[model samples]
Target: MLVKMYYNIKIIIFKLACFKLALPADGATGEHEDTSQPRQVTSTRRTQVSVRGPDSPKIRGEVHAPIRGLKCLCTNAHSMGNKQEELALLLADTNPDIVGLTETWWESTHDWAVNIKGYRLFRWDRKGRKGRGVAPYVKKQYTSLPNSVGSEDGQTEMLWVRIQGGQGQRDLMVGVYYQLPNQGEELDWEFSGQLVETVKSRDVVIMGDLNYPDNCWEEQSARSDRSHRFLAEIQDLYLTQEVHSPTRANALLDLVLATGNDLVRGLQVLDHLGDSDHCLLEFTIQLRVSKACSKAAALDFRRADFNELRRLVGEALRSQRVRELRI
Candidate 1:
């Protein structure tokens, strides 16, 4: 019985050994199991991506001009919309340093000033109750004068700014004015006279939608020369006429006047009148400072000094010794 049990245990052990050898090297329990080599470990890191909206456009660098200084624009503010944006883009293409908008019907609470990329804004609107007002958009890089001097009518306003020229000298002062369309002839005359007087003391460029026809004599003689006295005042002040309409018919009422003999070397009538009733006036003045005038300006000739010099010269001449010395 013991011999028979030993033989049965040996047979069982042999059967278990045979079963283990029949299995695959990976010890798979099923016939359909995958025996291919293991896939190589892929070490990948998760990355983040940034996205921009569709409306954003890439910005180009600053524009270059033959002349460097303050460039001015005068446009009547009809309203702010797609038309207005087109106008702004048009002005941006020209790259004016300063822009004066008249009849701007902007609420004091809203963003009255817009970003021209590298520009700052100085805006003044009449009281909300008041009908209309003026605003100036100046380039951010330039320095603006502290005070903007003007008349009380609110029909016209001026911006005073010291512009550094490419020659590295203070060469320009820009004054932007906007007068109402129907401000009586007397008031027109008065305002024109005031503008001329104010700008005469400085090197100025006066640009605006004066609302008076360039050919006042031809179009509205009934209003008379008094209504268009601003043009006369500008001409009388020795400010060279940089831009004036060529034909009385379909002519632009906008004007650009430059002080002294610097003639407007270039004038362009931009094709953007669809946005506003008035066409865009663009002109360039070649400013050449006179050395003699500059020297006179630098001299410290105070009123007291002038009086003393005259008195001393008179006394020295009266004295016989001084006269003899000259003789």
Candidate 2:
């Protein structure tokens, strides 16, 4: 009976091992098996987020806008004189991208911004009774930064503007300056030195009735060095014409200096506005990117050794024997 029980137990253990082998492993099961629960398929559907390009449809209007050239006008309107009507007419007809008006009597006048159609105005007021100021009128099509600096004596005004161009964009820092009349050499030197020191390090255009002409005025002969150095540092946009006037005479006072690329090509003195003492100065600037220089090609000239040639000639002469047979 004990032997029978041991044989039965061995048979049962073999059967159990076979049953365990027949069953499926932990994660491995045949597709046809209905005994196991169906696996929940975790979806891997990639959420495709649409990305927008720089020239996408949302910004198509701005991308499609045509790039245009920028035209800047600079003038010293002679604040002592009342010539608003004349200035308005001239500005209206000229239609400059920006107009820099210097020596404006801002303290005396209540209305600073003289609104012209298709143009936006910016002005800096002067201190009490000084009558020195600068104003810039930009076209409505373009945008400008908020005014930062104004003049107290109505002699200087600085404004910043951003202009979009075909190739890229440009920042314009324009200054309208009107030096004190009859300030003498010392004052002129001091003022010019200040201006040079202030603007020499930055990209800027100093334009307006500088009062100091390129040529030595009777008043400026003593301080000619200061004026010359100042003019030399900044490229004179009015080089071709001695004096930009309706009539011919050498009196170049109003000027424009381009700090970046010498984009200023020409400056034309427009027809005088009524009886205003100062004339309007208009400038034409062409924007362009600088190009890289190419390398030069090597020359292929033959070089001869004089000593070698001489030695070869001597050897040839020595080798050749002039044999003369006497007849």
Candidate 3:
């Protein structure tokens, strides 16, 4: 009876060992390949992207002519999305001295990547707001200051930098601003007096996505208190609205307002760039002596080949027979 019981125990233990051997090893996922099934992609991240417009700005290796003193370009990105890359490329192609962008919709989590080659970026983030922000990039080559001398503080979502150059070294108070929809009237009323005071006799250029419809521009708005108030401030400040063309969908959302029209020149609306609803507002400083009209000679650096010139001079002198080679 004892022998029979021991034999039964051994048989049960053998069966348990066989079952354990058949099972998968520790930490095994039990994964299997199925040719008919689509392979799953691991570690994929969702890329936030924007719908690029038909007239999205393209990158060209060509560099445009530089404006003396300052050449500024303003545009509303609507939503920068992945187009900051394209925007930087476009800026390199156009080569503006300063760039103002509105509606960037930039968030804290976003990786700041819209750095042009030689510009210093000043940003005023729109905290707790969606699809609204303001920033400006000023070229390092220019003489710019953190703030203009004798300048006062501005309202929220506004940034200013003083550029001192042009005819007679005239100082320009450059700024980038964004007033939220239904918030314009308040801004005009609240900051109107302060802004006028802050600019304080300096030539002013305050630009960005004002968001006011073009119909309201100049004097088309009869009932819009905000429009009237905004326009009133502009007139009171002696700022000329340089952008007459529609920025987005037949509406002039982006604006370029200058205090002294004589301080700026060649106001032009450029083609739509990279996924932006608005167009580019391009202009240069209007110096007392315009480069084109003045007889003042400009150094022709682009056509100059210093080495070739040196070689030519050396050859001419080497072959010439001098009448008297005196000191």
Candidate 4:
């Protein structure tokens, strides 16, 4: 079993780096959970109007109806270059309820730069660095709004949001991070610990360009000490990784880690936009019903009315014996 998992990881990682991971029939790195009873496949109702964007017409998948939790899209926009219009159109077409953008490379002062119609944006920008920022976009239709928790970690860019989507879902928490490459140092375990501590007692989704890879998870050590600590810190939080496909330049730097199996209804790796090196992680958030699914009760047929049947059988046998003697 261990060998099979490692083998799968190796094969998927290789394909991810090549940017070839797509479609389940094409062997994408997706292991969808199906045990939940309340989960339903998303229906794509045909529309007459034309939607603008490169990926809009191409976007097709099982998107759940937003009666519960909303659909979510995560990506690293990487400085918001020529792909801004393309990315916005893709979101507008797909109609995800929430979207997370990391490495935005835009400062908070440039609020007018981002334009996605009908959605309220929550963002945290980096002033000093040339390439650092994080934020989530919540759709207007959602009743429970999301609030920014601020970047509690100083060393790396970290962003957290409290998504209040009424009760029964327990309110979802999302943490975004951009751990820049070649920092010449290890991850601050203290700060990582604080990120985990903040999302306690809630259904959380931690998604970003984590920038740590583990071709080495099988060895109990990683390609770098950096990855080793990353795996450890997340494990301490009991968050399972939902997005395993490679996000950028064939490495699985981008990820979506959540608290339970049913939180993410679906996930896909999309083609990169314009000159961006990273692809998109398109995923959906299963509503409250899917999250709270309980197995139906069963009955044991063998335990039913056996004693009464035995008595009736004995009476029948005695009557048969008496009739045989008379004959």
Tens digits of per-residue lDDT for model 3, 1-327 = 445544654554443333222333322223332233222222122332111111111111112123355778888777777778888887878898888888778877664575667988777666776667878889865545444222244445677776534323334567788777667444555556547655554557888887778345655453576667677777777778877778778888788877776766788988776867678888885533223333333443444555655565455445423213321
Per-residue lDDT tens digits for candidate 4, residues 1-327, read 444544654554443333322233221112332233232222243422111111112112222232465677788888774567887888878888888888777765566768688887776777676677887887755432333232444555666655443323334666777777756454465446556565555567778887766644334457767777677777777767787667776688888878877887679998875677888888877645323333343344344455555565456445654456552
For candidate 4, give the lDDT: 0.61
Give candidate 4 misplaced runs (Cα > 4 Å). Answer: 1-67, 143-155, 184-187, 215-221, 287-327
Residue 285 in candidate 3, Cα distance off native in Å: 2.6
Candidate 2 lDDT score at position 95: 68
TM-score ranking, high to low: 4, 3, 1, 2
lDDT of 1: 0.50
**Number of the predicted model whose TM-score against the real structure is largest:** 4
Pairs that clash in candidate 2: 132-153, 132-154, 133-154
Cα error, candidate 4, residue 19 (Å) = 63
**lDDT comparing candidate 2 with the true structure:** 0.49
Query: Over the stretch 1-327, how does candidate 1's per-residue lDDT look in tens digits?
Result: 445544654554443332222322221112231223222212122332111111111111222222443455566655543355665676778787667666565565546445456766665566646445556677755434323344555344444444433221223556566666567765566566555555533456766666665344333232445444654665567766555463113755566666665545466655443456665665664544322212122222232344544555466456676455553
Where model 2 places Cα greater than 4 Å from the true spot, the runs are 1-67, 146-167, 182-203, 214-223, 235-249, 289-327
Question: Which digits, one per residue and each the tens of the lDDT, describe model 2 over residues 1-327?
Answer: 445544654554443333222333222212232223222212222322111111111110121122345677776665725677666777677667778887777664446446667877776666556667777777765434332332333233444343332222223345555665445665455544444543422335656666655444323232567566555534332222233343213566776656544556567777555555667777865554323222333322234344554565455344424122111
Worst 10 residues of 4 by lDDT: 49-58
Clashes of each: 1, 3, 2, 4
